[model samples]
Target: MTIIRSRDFTGGRPWAALDIASMNGIGTRLHWTDQPYIWHINEGQEVFVVLGGRVRMRYRKDGVEQAVVLAVGDIFYAEIGCEHLAEPLGEARVLVVEAVGSL
Candidate 1:
């Protein structure tokens, strides 16, 4: 068994992650980032959880753009083909669970 403190975790680069588990081809990761992620769509569904700090999440739906500010313990669910981006308010730690190799 491995125990990790999400707030204490550090990554090599923005969205850099440590693989935590993979079951039935779904993967879970712990990540750290201080920069905004590129807008893109995931081939599969994703569960984004904020473990530390804050994030401004932006997404587009039905040709309309929307955004939400997420703080610690907040979660964002991204459906397949949903275009989205995440901009961190500062150094933040996040947990992302999605299909392996999904962007």
Candidate 2:
């Protein structure tokens, strides 16, 4: 068992993560970031949860770009091939579950 104080969690750098678990090739991680991630498509499904602060989520759908702001407690789901990007409003913590080794 593990206990994480999400508000107090910190990483070494932007997008740095604390791995929580891995099973069956899937991984759960807690990430800290203050930078925007490059847009990319995942090879498998992804579940993103905002644990602290705010984030601007950008994505391409039907070749058009769209974006939304996610606050604490918000969740984002990405299916395989879903092109997306994440930009922190400031500093933020996010919990992500996805295929291990996926970028």
Candidate 3:
């Protein structure tokens, strides 16, 4: 398998990735700190894998509110049409894979 790497956005501190293929659409999402507990949604479904550190995933209050604490190697999936929230517990790195389209 081929792995594509970013330009090291956070000085290689927090890494991110995206898996693109015909079978599924995936968009990688991440944050440098837990302060920015923001939420967003894409057109398709997505599953997030915490590659390193810890993270807390939640749904937008105005949207759906599903919360989950994720550690290293933890995997969570957001169903299609599910609006969500995500944040790093500290300095964290995450990888997201899902059935999706363009960014």
Candidate 4:
């Protein structure tokens, strides 16, 4: 468990971008529109830092479902095998760190 500042990790527009597999993996665009975007279960644990706009996350944790709406600087964790989904709120950005293919 670590605490990282959102400003220090982002895409440089409003925040940084990180790959779920590579810590240095930044800005890959999670936006999935114009088609059917299916949010899947996380293969492993994951974390993220909200940058611009808002991040809406829907996932399963501890036998229950959870929905998290995070604003700038907000932090989140996605447990392993937990089905999760995320999307930006009106052109939002975030710094995400997690397994190679968690969500």
Say which prediction, candidate 1 or candidate 2, comes out ahead on lDDT: 2
**lDDT assessment of candidate 1:** 0.94
Residue lDDT tens for model 3, 1-103: 8554422334333333333344423444542443434466757777777766788887754554667889888887776666777777777666666544423
Better model by lDDT: candidate 2 vs candidate 4: 2
Candidate 4, 1-103: lDDT as tens digits: 5455433443443322343334553223332121122577656666666665677777777768788788877887766676777666655666556555434
Candidate 4's TM-score reads: 0.57
The 10 consecutive residues of candidate 3 with the worst lDDT sum are 6-15
Clashing pairs in 2: none
lDDT of each: 0.94, 0.95, 0.59, 0.55
TM-score against truth, every candidate: 0.97, 0.97, 0.61, 0.57
User: What lDDT score goes with residue 34 in model 1?
Assistant: 98
Q: Whose TM-score is greatest here?
A: 2
Comparing 1 and 4 by lDDT, which wins?
A: 1
| Residue clash pairs of candidate 3 | 25-98, 25-99, 25-100
Cα error, candidate 4, residue 69 (Å): 1.1
State in Å the error of residue 4, model 1: 0.6
Worst 10 residues of 4 by lDDT: 28-37
In candidate 1, where is summed lDDT lowest over 10 consecutive residues? 5-14
